[model samples]
Target: MATENNVLLTDTADGVVTLTLNRPDQFNALSEALLAALQDSLAAIAQDDSVRCVVLAANGRAFCAGHDLKQMRANPDQRYYEQLFAQCGRVMQSIVNLPVPVIAKVHGMATAAGCQLVASCDLAIAADTAKFAVSGINVGLFCSTPAVALTRNVSAKKAFEMLMTGQFISADDAAAQGLINHAVPLDQLDAQVDALVQTICAKSPVAVRTGKGMFQRQRVMSLGDAYDYAGQVMAQNMMAEDVAEGIDAFTQKRHPVWKGR
Candidate 1:
């Protein structure tokens, strides 16, 4: 377990690393410091083979309120804004580039960049009472950065509506719209997330890694290229020791003893 800058906290157990945004007072806003902390943590996790899964969880009443407006306003310079956004973009990209999958555990408000964080994750689960929006439009600023991730998860029209209208949607609505995987009662949120984590952790690490990497990369490729690439990935996956064990165990009617990494 580790806490950095008192803005981010990390704990790992049973191969799952939970990175918690610790700024409860600010609704866990993406302050510059917090973004830097996340970047560092993510980089470290990318190289950590011991970690099989990541849970992007947060503390406090709101999951996140987006950028630290006060901090941004304090340095109201074009150069500052450009650098700030670029930094934020890198952090988001890092999440997508991570070898292991990340699951966002959302509660309360997840607005603007907060919502982007959820969308950037490989999977997300939210409390039914949670609310989400790309509400920068209300402040006369289009959520351009958030849009990149949002549009990838949601339909163009639906994502545009959220960006243009700045209207909050319920967690169930978010799930239905594909912004989140599931929305459960607040009390059941942890259980649901834990169940999902366990389900993923039970699989062969090599298969999970190979599949996640190929899944994202193949999305942007042409249909023919995608199939050709997927075939290569699958062929490589078949060569893993765990795959052999997995098939053998299935044939023998026994649980697989996974040793892949």
Candidate 2:
């Protein structure tokens, strides 16, 4: 994925995979090829057992400005727009559906669907100077799709306000609004992201994967149904070798050596 002029670049180290958006000149806009690349990479990561975590980073000064507006203007077809939005939605859902956690390493600005990318992630860490917005309305278009992910991550009123006003918020405000996990100095952004990645990598991969799937599925369930489903999941988790090893390690006052991912 690191080929010359590749729209997406990928690197893996220490059970962590970093996927970098490579459209620097275009501010990492999610063009058609870029969207396809993202979907393909995420699909592959879903099956890769060695990948304990994923970091979504960008190469440019701007994280992502959103969809490729020029491309959209070139087509100007309703059907094409429908398919494009659908594809973008799948990419967002793919992030939420991936077995391992995805952390957005945000810098500069992330607006519209770019901000949706941050929302789709399980966690996000942004530089203090980074900015976020759902600014489709500024162009006379509504950010209907980004609103889906945004509202799920942030309060309904705040999400609506961003959509309506087309205003940007600083990274710290994004964190306070629940759109991102933390915002640190630009120089320390990588360190903060790495600290979180290391923490996740230290946990049992089996438990992490199982919990992620269950957490997503049970969110839409009724209270009683959610409890029932969680109980079943926990019961099954107890049977995993890693769980047994973890309990044994706790009793023995030692670190657990996980057996399965």
Candidate 3:
């Protein structure tokens, strides 16, 4: 039987795993099932040695509208919301802490927790027609969950303004604010994402994984500590087989063939 916790669609190719939010009718809102599915997908991806990158995308006109308000209204239980947010947080944290890089492919509206999802990813690409907002304040509910990722990705003042105003911003605006890496026409979104994934996949997977981990770990540390940590990581990576192969390829003036070692 199709399970409640299996709402997410996953596809893997060339070391990239794309996870799609599948609740189209609700604009891909985060329901208990969707949230659980996201967590499960991330957990599985983390253990899969073949997967080196993840792309979080959606199938609806809206990337996500945040939590499933109808479900919350029907249940009318604060405990339910609590549990849902907790699970959502775990999923977001998994993206941030994953050794593989994650990219958010934003196609339409991304609001509230949806906007936070983009912020949590290591890189984000959006269609020029897409928009983003922290709209919780509009409904008299502050977006506490989304704030965790949003605040970290952009400056505190910028993040606070978006949340407090509850206003929508264009994809270009999002890119300018550092919320996304690039914004292209809607028709070009897939091609752009594919190009990006291919570029990342062409690199040494082992170095990519190690470097991504180091970037996450050192970002939260003091400058000296970060340098010390990076030095250790670089020293270790220098001895890896991929590094040796890369050096040999450079000496021979040829494209390096990565074994993903």
Candidate 4:
């Protein structure tokens, strides 16, 4: 659905929600209004059990160009900057906190906070022509905010190189550095993203939701703690009716009918 201003467009089908960033003329920069819209959309989707997956896509020549530089300059104050970054951070974290999986579909340049957006998603599929960079340094900023998610997705050395040098990396390099899941030709970008979405949608929703949460939580834990947490999650998952159905169907050589318990 198109927002009042049409800055963001959303469409849902087959249990998948597609959130498309509009404002192509501005390279889909994250203006305050756009951020608010996105925040609201994510919040709504989080509560919508019907949504099994979300695709974060964009229109125009660039996926996103980071924060609105003009708007930033317009209000050059410490408090304003702090609030803006905080708002952006909330939006990014919402994606991680969402029970369902989120996939970034990148087809053009994604810079600064844009790159951060890609890093924040659980999965990212970029087109061969897509480019990524944390280029805030080029404009006298340090990309400190974007670095939060960027550091988590890639190695410290590689993340620092991009943040400090403000250089762009090809989609293939992004995938190699673990910043994205895969890089395909521009023509296949949609199909590749859809394929992943379909795969996730085919799974039991309850299992996928539990697994996604466990995956994120374990990432920040010690190895031993991770295993402990994982074991608990597995035990809980086994108690779900879907698990029994899945096992029985497997042994019986029949397709499992998931109740999403």
CA-lDDT, candidates in order: 0.95, 0.94, 0.90, 0.95
Output the lDDT of residue 5, model 1: 62
Index of the highest-TM-score prediction: 1
Q: Model 1, poorest ten-residue lDDT window?
A: 1-10
lDDT of 1 at 32: 97
Report clash pairs, candidate 4.
1-10
lDDT string for model 1 (9-68, tens) is 998888999999999999999999999999999999999888899999999999999999
Our model 2 lands, by Cα RMSD against the true structure, at 1.2
Question: Which ten residues in a row are the worst by lDDT in model 4?
Answer: 1-10
After superposing candidate 1 on the true structure, give the runs of residues whose Cα lies further than 4 Å from its correct spot.
2-4
Q: What is the lDDT of residue 177 in candidate 3?
A: 91
lDDT accuracy of residue 44 in candidate 2: 90
Per-residue lDDT of candidate 3, residues 1-261 (tens digit): 122334688887767888989888899998888888888888888898888788899987999999888888898788977888898899899999898999999999999999999999999999999999999999999999899899888889989999999999999999999999999999999999988988888899999899889988898999999999999999999988999999999999999998877
Per-residue CA lDDT of model 4 for 159-254, tens digit only, reads 999999999999999999999999999999989998899899989998999998999999999999999999999999999999999999999999
TM-score of model 4 vs. true structure: 0.98
Question: Ten-residue segment with the worst summed lDDT in candidate 2?
Answer: 1-10
Q: Count the backbone clashes (under 3 Å) in each candidate.
A: 0, 0, 0, 1
Where does model 4 exceed 4 Å of error? 1-5
In order of appearance, the predictions have TM-scores of 0.98, 0.97, 0.95, 0.98
Candidate 4 overall Cα lDDT vs. reference? 0.95
